[model samples]
Target: MRDLRARFRAAYGASGWHLLLLVGCFAVAAWVALRLAGEATAGRMLLWFVGAVVAHDLVLFPMYAAADWALRTAVRERRARPASGPSLLNHLRVPALAAALLFLVYLPGILRQGRETYLAATGQDQQPFLARWLLASGALFLASGIRYAFRRWRARRG
Candidate 1:
């Protein structure tokens, strides 16, 4: 069993389950592409897809990479103990990423750009979006800070 597993892993560069999941994802993507190809809006969809790829590669990736590099440099400069169990970088990163994603998802609402159309469609005002987003972001950061403090306390205690 071990030999067979090793052979499969050697051939696939991953375990059987991982390979299966990869193939499943590919199959779903192919299905979605085929369906999209048959649609009248395929060209527009393709344009959006290409634009997203280009925007992420050319804009978002570099921006985030630079931010992360700067953050790491600052953290490294301030570190007093070399024996810390884990860095606080990820703790900050996870919440910031979540908040950023939420902001992106609700950008039009947060900016109050679609007020008339939103009111017409939903019969509700878009006035709360900015406040809600701010509150959510603040809560997320607070939770992340508490979690980091707890982890640091446990690390020091143990």
Candidate 2:
């Protein structure tokens, strides 16, 4: 118990300063981004940022939370009833919503028709755009998983 506590304290101390530095940098960046926006013009960029924050907090977060809660509660109720398990859409919620969020977040890049345009330009069907995007995300997930596994393995070895 003492050894575990010591290790935890060591890790915390090592991380604390780095986390504080990161947060300070992030605050400065955000301030600079907002401040750097147009002072001569109508300040459209700041307005966009404010709108995005409100939309994300008021609309997106609540919608996703309600959807997840509803699906979970329905699943629980279905377990009790045994007749109604889950709606088809409910079953698809997490994946579909995740994909939508992914696609939406990269809306500009997606619409700029990056790899999709290149594929079409090369006489390939645009259908592969979806596959390509998924492949890219899958690779990212794989990388993250590998990194996490490596970290855990190292921590255990230490």
Candidate 3:
């Protein structure tokens, strides 16, 4: 059994489960493509996909990569001792990523771009989106800060 597993891993470059999961994901993607093929909006979806890929590759990727580099550098420079675990960089990163995802998901509502259409459809105002997003982001940061501080306190006590 060990020899068989080793030979399979050597040939596949990962465990059998990894190959199974990869095949499953590809199957789902193929299903989605087949379903979308009959849709009239497929062309528009394709155009949007291409645009999103271009935007992420050309703009967002660089911006975030540079920002991460700067943050990592700043944290490393100020640290007098090597981090034991859960570096400050990661604590800051988690909140920032969560906030960014929230902002991206609610961009239209937050920016009030389709205020009239949104109001007509949901019978609700878009006025609260920006404030709610800000508050949620602030809460996330605050919680992360509290958790980091607690960890540091426990580490010091130990």
Candidate 4:
């Protein structure tokens, strides 16, 4: 049994279950792509996908990579001792990433860039998006700060 398991791992680069799940995901994606290809808007969807890939690779990737490098440099300077466990970087990163993702997902609404179309489609106003995004971002940061403070307090107590 042990030899069989090792052989499977060596052959697949992972456990059988992981490979099964990956193949299942690919199958679903292929099915969805086939369905979409039969639609009239397939070309438009493909164009948008290519645009998104280009935009992310050419624009967003560099911007975020630079931001991460700057953040790491600044944080490295501030820490007195080497990180022995999970670093403080992740504590800052998680909330920032979450907020950024939320902003991106609602970019049109947040900027009111699609107000007329959004209103026409949903019969709702996009007026609250900016404020709501700001509030959510603020809350994310506030929670991260509180968690950091609590961790620091615990460390000091210990």
Tens-digit lDDT track of model 3 for 1-158: 99999999999899999999999999998898899999999888888988999989998899888987887877874442435644588888889889988998889988999878888999998888899999999999999989988988887788
Question: If ranked by lDDT, best first, what sequence of candidates would result?
Answer: 3, 1, 4, 2
RMSD of 3: 6.6
Comparing 2 with 3 on lDDT, the higher-scoring candidate is 3
Runs in model 2 deviating more than 4 A are 1-38, 73-94, 111-158
User: What is the TM-score of candidate 4?
Assistant: 0.65
Better of 1 and 4 by TM-score: 4
Clashing pairs in 2: none
Of candidate 1, the 10-residue stretch with the lowest lDDT total is 77-86
Candidate 2 lDDT tens digits, 49-122: 78899989999899888977776666665443334333333334545565667777766455555666666677
Query: Please, what is the whole-model Cα lDDT of each candidate in the order they appear?
Result: 0.85, 0.64, 0.86, 0.83
Residue pairs whose backbone atoms clash in candidate 4? none
List TM-score per model, in order: 0.64, 0.37, 0.67, 0.65
Number of the candidate with higher TM-score, 2 or 4: 4
Q: By descending TM-score, how would the candidates be arranged?
A: 3, 4, 1, 2
